[model samples]
Target: MLRRTLAAVAAAALAFVAPVQAQAPAAAPVEIQFWHGLPQPLGGLLEKIVSDFNASQARYKVVPTFRGSYAETMVGAVAAFRSSSAPHIVQMFEVGTGTMMAAGRAIRPVHELLASTGVNIDFADYLPPVRGYYQAADGRQMSMPFNSSTAVMFYNKDMFQRAGLDPNAPPKTWAEVEAAARKLKEAGIACPMTTSWPAWIQVEQTLAIHNQPLATQANGFRGMNAEMRLGGALMVRHMQNLVEWQRQGLFRYGGRDSAADGLFPSGECAMAFASSGLRARVMREARFQWGTAMLPYYNDVAGAPRNSIIGGASFWVMNKGPNAGETGGRSAAEWRGVAEFFRYIASPEVDAKWHQDTGYVPVRRASYELTRRAGYYAANPGADVAIESLLRGGAATDNSRGIRLGGYVEIRTIIQEEMEKAFQAGQSAQQAMQAADTRANAVLRNFERQNARAAQ
Candidate 1:
């Protein structure tokens, strides 16, 4: 009888233990590393998106690392790739598109990556300009468009009123811009006008807006033999005007890149030609009323004010593997996780939220429609200026589409250097234009040579 009792107790213990063994803890979610180049509030907003995504899903946790400026981030990503420790995604500026496209075995086209995981993204949902900028020659998307922006005029309405200019009317032409600058200067405004990304605003976007060519072969889209066309009559005239304005204190040369972005918000400069993305910063930091308008043009050039091209960065997926441009040894599940994360962000609700928060043009048309329906544009006047500027002209011509040339980052540096020399009276505007053309062409030729070597 005692033996039977002991056997019954053993059977109960075994049943309890079996249930406990069957209920092992779930596996931890996969972690994805994303590197980007955005400062301050923008970076904080991006993290919020990632955090919300993590909370919604149990499969992946995305960790974003701010990798300094665009140039620094690109350099770091390249080094990471060489060391076989690259992050899954990197935010590369639009100018680096050519370089990223040429990086064999280093990048995995997002379309292909998603399709491999049974997820097909409809590129049609994205805006044409935003879509076209990142597409391959074969119509395949090379990367995911994020934070796309264009140049615009940001002016302080209070200053405009004080300067005796029409506060409701912003400058519409280069002549008008100059005239307004003079008024602002006369009104005791020390820094009447300044520009961020001088090369982009004064050169690339200027060429596109005026329907001028920056390079031959349809702005380098046709082939790699495209040469610089920087010394045109219009460019020379515009550069000369900038130099004259600087001399008269109508315009101030506020350093390079985005270093001059603060001048407007800090109330130091009354007017600024800067990225539309500056809307977010200006809104948060500006103490006075501000307004945004389309970039000014010369009006004499045929098809002038065509459209401005995108200036912000895109998300590039890196493939760091030993194979020849194959997968990065990531498991199928992991790729699915990445695809899922992308799908979540690309949804209309999430995308619209990002656009509204960051001052970037919505990549997806659906997102724009959603934001409009939600009364975002009505509540915030001038928020749609970027979109309107991009769609000002009918269809984007070759001149207004975008620039795709290797070593463009270096070329921009060269242009800025030459322009600085002109502003300081070290060289004439005409001479600066000629020097930039010559030096930029050399950089292109060197890029071609490097590409040839890599292919062989």
Candidate 2:
């Protein structure tokens, strides 16, 4: 009788516990924070990508936060790192490559992170120039190239017709470009030509496309002690041309960075030298027909049409510290989540869509092929100009490969400042470039001093 009573009591207890267990809520998904700098539709698209990833799996949730412009975003990230509150992933512009690479213990290299998390993304699968820009000296990829772009010529076809110029035959040489600009001016165009990213389009890309080095030691790729060589013959000639054009009212000096991007779409400027990524914005805002072509080159230079270097930013993963039960470094679960998110974004479908939607060149070979096979490039004429320009010479030379200089952001500012002074203050182009070279070298030396331990 005593055994039977005990059995009944145990069975009742088990039944009550099972009901309570069944009513318990499931564990919350891991939240992975991603910080980036792209604005507007790009940021919205990125968020949608995160949403899709979250919907695809229940174990992870990625939240994308747009910090600001590229420069602001980088500054914010640095501050966050100092405070030990950095996000899992941060988008950094290409010029900031050296800074990110030298940030020892603050970054977790993409290669190392992927390996630790058992994610297999072959760096070889990415475009050569895209992958090459973010690689360390040993060729290990340091970050993930996301929005890769190259400088290209965007011109108003209607304006060309108005100027009695051939709309289809865009200018291919600097001489031809000058002639066209003059014709447009004669046709009563207020702003015959303008360029965004003066330092990048007029200086850096000019050097790269002409197969010239922006700095010594293979543009700082070989070592950190490289010095500026901007006051060279070619740079002087180009700067002088720009100054002359400005004086003749044939070219308008757009503000720094992408401030001049609007002049083209608003139909004020007939021609623009800007990032190929501007295609999307131009397509959206322009009421008249527009076309794109490779950037005009100096035909007299040897290998005059060498490949242009990439301009857009890449995604850098951050490291907090060693994990201490979630209070320090990223946990293994978080790393897995990040790796999964990267794999999702890098897949052919996602990458190709991103390239198509944002006008960014496809970073991965598979993505490019997939888009081409789908007839995307054919449907969107001139869309392939960026990739073509990047692959112009078949092989990247030391000068045309890519710039990897430290403190290049500040150096670019110095270039723009000197160029402005040359345009407005009556300073000779030669003198301005010489000043730029001197000031920029000081920044490089300071960066070298700060990162001396990296060399060791």
Candidate 3:
């Protein structure tokens, strides 16, 4: 009787312990790495978002690493990928879309990953123009659009008032801009006009605003077989105007992007052409009252004043490693996470806050409407310029959507160098543009041939 009682008690204890062991949670968290170019405040913002995501979930955790600027981050990712140690996602600039897409089997399409995981993400809800560049010809999204921005004019209200120009009415055409520059210069303003991202603000904006193509085949939308078209009459005329303005003491050509930004925020320049995304930085740095305006257009050009192109970056997902799973495979759970993240980021409230903070256009129509209904535009008077610039009912021509060329970042550098020669040196505008066109074509052709072979 004693042995039976002891055995029964022991079996009961064993059963209780087995149930507790079976209900215990698993060890270790799934780590997902993200590499981005945002620094300081923006970087902090990203970390906060990731932290929130982690705290809201139990299975996966996101780790964000700042890998320097966009170019540096891309180079680092390429090197890391070769060693099979890249982050799950890398943020690349808008100009890098062609290169990233041509990177062969290295990247996985965002759509494919989401569909495989049974996550329902509506691509149509995203703003068409903002997401268009990252989409395939058939309209499949390849990357996640983040920090999309367009070029705009920045002017000092006090300077305009002092120059006897209406502070509320900014220049609407290229001719008016020149007149204002002359007025500001005559009024003894030290630097009447300057610009940042010369290639982007001056050349790219100039091309788009004038409704002219930057390359053959509608700015490379057709394919890699396209050639540079920067030597056209419109381009030459614009360069000549800038060169002439420099000679007339109405415009100052700052060194490059950083130098130009310094000129504007330091109160040395009364007017500038810069990215709309610079609003936050300028608002923080500028001591004077300032406002933004739509980029000016040439009067003679037919269908002029088309939408400006984007200058920021997007996120691309890598297609290898545990996250990517086997060939043609992505783990259902991982895909679900990616899709959820995208949907969360694209939510109306999230996009509105991002746009309000970063000065980037809200990537959803409802976000814009929500902001307007909330009187964001009324509180911030000139804020609608960027939205109007983008959504104004212009036909979706290839030129207006912006360039889609490989090795375009290097090509932009070449353009800057050649334009500097024309504007700073004594080289004729025609000569400078011709040389730039020749050099840029070489890059385009080289990329075309290389990518063609890879495709085959």
Please report the candidate that would top lDDT against the real structure: 2
Candidate 1 has an lDDT of: 0.86
Comparison by lDDT, 2 against 3, better one: 2
Model 1, range 1-456, lDDT digits (tens) per residue? 777566556655653553344344575677788999998888898888889999997767788999999999999999988887888889999999888877767888888888887886778888777877787766788888888999999999999999999988999999899999999999999999999999999999899888899999878876678999999998999999999999999999999999999999999999999999998889989999999999999988888878789988999988653342334645455566777778877888888998998899988889999999999999999999998888778677777878888899999999999999999999999999999999999999999988855533
Candidate 1 versus the native: TM-score? 0.90
Clashes of 1: 0
In model 1, the clashing pairs are none
- Tens digits of per-residue lDDT for model 3, 1-456: 787566556655654553344335673445677899988888787677778777876666678899999999999998877766777778999989889877766787888777765666666766666877787766788889877888888999989999999999999998999999989988999789888898888888788877788998778766778889889999999999889998888888887755687776777899888888778888889999898999888878888877777778888888553222243223334445566666667778877888887788887788899999999999998887887887654545677777788999989899889988887666998998999999988998889888897544
Evaluate model 2: give its TM-score: 0.91
Kindly give the stretch of ten consecutive residues in candidate 2 with the minimal lDDT sum. Answer: 321-330
Error of 2 at 15 (Å): 36
Clash pairs detected, candidate 3: none
Candidate 3: list runs displaced more than 4 Å: 1-27, 321-330
